[model samples]
Target: MSTPASRPVTAPATALSGPGSPRPYQSYVYAYPHKTAYRPLEDRPALRALWAREPKDALSLYLHIPFCEVRCGFCNLFTRIGAPDELTGRYLDALDRQAVAVREALGDGTPVRFAAAAFGGGTPTFLTAAELERLCDIAEKRMGADLTAVPLSVETSPATATADRLAVLAERGTTRVSIGVQSFVDAEARAAVRPQRRADVEAALGRIREAGIPVLNIDLIYGIDGQTERTWLSSLDAALGWEPEELYLYPLYVRPLTGLGRLGAAGDAAWDEQRLRLYRAGRDHLLARGYEQVSMRMFRRRGAPPSASDDHACQTDGMIGLGCGARSYTSALHYSFDYAVDMGQIRRIIDDFTTTEDFSRAEVGRRVDEDEARRRHLLQSLLQAEGMDVAGYRERFGVVPAGHFSAELERFAARGWLDTAAAPGRLRLSPEGLAHSDALGPELFSPAVRAAMASYELK
Candidate 1:
């Protein structure tokens, strides 16, 4: 197996333009310090040893299907173009092997109860109906994660969200189906290097409705090359037409190694302002239409069922990831197969993952120290609209977040980004702060983690 040479990921002093400025869209703090921060374990820890003391209750199961019909330009996710004919079958077989190994590692008598589950990747729907059924069986039978008892979400693309696949997902008790409709305008879609027509996207939406899934989430992108306020509103209106249970308005970020990155697309002050404007506009539009703001990117209809339960948070709750791209999380460490954006590197890693006979040890990961865990808990909690529970933080870490992150909190409060007055027991973000979440998230990363992630092998 080959990996890229290491290089520190520290940004130049000049890159940080002070806390007052709207920093460039550098990162989205989605799943706690990203997989880039993870490195090969010098001594691969046995699964049984690593998870021996971790909580079995409130676990989340994530299945990664790293295959897509077409690669989106702006996307830097660890997924490859469509799998060849027999490759899908082999991949599922490998997944089954991994699941069996993981379940066994949980200990024969331990009862691991999963509170939530998700199928994400290049696209979960890329698999055939039969293949999807097998995927469900692996989750339910091999891993023993009850699908019907918990909330299950699956991601899909228009081309792959076929009727047959939807049928299998619906029958298997999928509560939420998030479809990537990036944009309703054909021009914007083409500009993003994700080719799809309005008619085709509409058809896919219709099919998803026909599948009888309870919740529908439509994802749209803002700040494309030629996207304007009018076009953005049009896309917003189109999404609202379905009265989707949830809507995610993502700001376009041209990251390194992505198709847009190769072209060196818009990454300037003007573009940032445009994206911010569009985001606010979209947020307000959704709110006016009876959608509640979950975060800067997510808005849900008031009456819609939640995407995940109130009790389960991926950062706090343990997760078992089941594919090459998936990252399994324990309280102390996050582990997964090597991460790569290049197609050749991804294929190599996937090939290794599929051929591996031993699935009892972790190959790549970073140890999450106590401080880092606190930072992660604060980040995961504060980023959401509901905010962090001060008493809960104290209960877990024996200190309040405000005192722990005093300097950062002071800066955010001084800048009017933190709403401390609203809830004495919670630490939440102000509207302005949520709007600049990308910039704020990176600021909270510990220096060591920043350097490690910066030094990660991109290819």
Candidate 2:
């Protein structure tokens, strides 16, 4: 990540000095304008108008399934523990309703097309084989996304990666299947409250490989209690045995309302140091083993087939998300059904989503304006190893990032995190900057978004 020299600073900002420097690990900024920043839309904007002027070609489609067999200790996702036999059907029935409404909203105008699609949730595979087939039908028949043509990715768990469920996904043209194997060590699994034996995880992975899906993704987590470098590598090598096409190495966070949070598990500077050390180890291990780093948490095998479905950046393009836990994005607004982590509140939201007859309007959301949009563009682009394109910023916003984010860039340069020799028209992060992406991402949050996210109630 060599870059141009001497970052310039003409604006004032928070200090990122050597002494008492910010912790490398902050909140993960996977999405700009985090859901916590969203609120109930009193006006209830119609989905029709939301997409009327927005670009529709090459859109990304997502469907959320909020039911999971078991909730992990560190999980704070909007998902319930299990669905009653009747609940799954009710959920799909509701999904079909939402899809039909959304398709109608797209209005067969401006050549609407979905370039990629994903099934995510508590675990999309929580549904039975027949239910999964129905889920795909809802996306293709009702929502008008051609699953067979697009790169379709689905999330599954060790318990739910059953052969029958996987067969449905394969038949429906699933190109990628990601299973969260946080750790292959039984002890670490127990500490994470993700109850499963090594035997079961191995069996599940076998089924995934046997299913003949093109790309397989394994998700591993660092920073579990009682984890050490040796055991971390043990888990890493265990995952390597499957030669997964993609791997996500996540840093565990004991967020509020999660099992670890309830048990008072907290992060300290020492813990941060441990996670950083482990992250570097894991990263280097994968890189040496013929895996290329996509981001801090994602790595792909060197010759893996391109998975464009995962590349639909909502920061610029539009995305359509269905189901209670899913979210959608347009150029000016990001909307979702509701946001929650508490089990009781989550269940309430799921129940509400299942019985609703109308799905024509946005329930809760936040509108993105020009300035916030600029920040998002810079933040997301800079977080990548390739960095942002200077020309693209000017074309979109009529200004260069170095000038708009001068103070932030200067701070990063001072810390040696911003590349000083990147080619002209390119803004990239130094290796260290990508390593501390969690912290760097948060620093770019606009004051209003930061305040809103701060004030949001977890429940």
Candidate 3:
């Protein structure tokens, strides 16, 4: 297994300029320009077909916990803030019903082998110790008896994690915990509406470590309104001092319908060049401290293996989701549900449910044909720190990457954006390329996708 401290720091690529400079207008539309259209979950016929055809040993799971003590200003995830006692009981009842419904839809005899199971949102720890255990038990019963041995992960806020809560998670098969430690600076934390004190964070970390979980992934955000280069760098240093097994560095995105979005709309917030500089400075600081860039917004300690990287790849593979406001994806379709209804009312209903049915898969193959080549290139490039292997591409896609992306490859090479000579079968972003990596996805998106992404907003 690779350790996180031994990876080399590649320099960021210089800006791709001149007449052929990759135009932002072409790609800056959707959060995921190439994302498949929303498919409703109520389409029973299609869902049945999916269950019948799904490979028995090839599924994963994602469970969402939607209770938070306070809502963060920048958060756009599906979660509710307020009293937990009344909410937990209702949410669990609804979750159980949904699980049963999915099980029945998939059929009882189907053998499901989950590659990974992740608990995310509000805070998995928001549930009482007993409730958490019961939820995991129910999941194990539905998936199989040996879920504990699988790669299980959960996300929690530092303020919600206690020694008891951590112990419950450890006993229930959690191998990793992603704590939302957005910033170590008190002012930044306050600005984000995260009520975590520095002491609270340290205590939470100590408890989680004591529980024997091997991977501790911490999240740090940059490009917020009140954040400065100095504060961001200092937070980075503070996070590193904790020696987390992995780290996710995300640039703050102001999404509509959120507090931050209103601020941006009112001209009180802006993601300017200085914010970009802060992100770059923080990235450089992480790299200098022995963290390897794993994705556009993530870094891990050097020598860490792919398995130890953030759970992004596992998520990409596919996962079954449980709970209200949870999303699930198979090889063919993606579905999600809204679970913010009256918990009291939901508990009374035996068939607790709210779902978006399947929309369309008729164009899947067509879109795949048009976009798969680049999608694979970008997905692999975006997730794996080692970059794409030409031989692997040929083996999987039945064609060399150069055959499809040769023009783009040449364009990057001319600007010193790639180190093509290091190995025949490998292509990695040059340091300059890393700096502008977010632009690559947009640059490669098709015109239709670019247009669709531009006007889309997450609801």
For model 2, residues 75-143, the per-residue Cα lDDT tens digits are 888789888759989999999999999999998768888989888888889999999999999998898
Off by over 4 Å in 1: 1-19, 22-24
Which tens-of-lDDT digit does each residue in 1-459 have in candidate 1?
000001112221225445556464667777666777888999999999988988887888889888888888988788888787688888999999999999988885556888888898878888989999999999999988889888999998888889999999999989999898989999999999999999999999999999999999998999999999999999999999998999888888777788988997747777878988899898888889899998877888998877686667655889889998888888888899898888889888888888888899999998999999999999888888878888999998998986789999898887788875667887889988888787778888999887887676679
Q: In model 1, how large is the Cα lDDT of residue 280? A: 88
> Ranking by lDDT, best first?
2, 1, 3
**Per-residue lDDT of 320-408 in model 3, one digit per residue for the tens?**
66765455555555455422223343233212332222221111211234354356445446334567766766775678777777777
Show pairs that collide, candidate 1: 7-455, 9-454, 9-455
lDDT of 2: 0.85
In order, the Cα lDDT scores of the candidates are 0.83, 0.85, 0.60
Clashing pairs in 2: 2-421, 2-422, 3-420, 3-421, 3-422, 4-420, 4-421, 4-422
Query: By summed lDDT, which 10 consecutive residues of candidate 2 come out lowest?
Result: 1-10
TM-score of each: 0.96, 0.95, 0.79
Task: Name the lDDT of candidate 3.
Answer: 0.60
Candidate 2: misplaced stretches above 4 Å?
A: 1-20, 310-313
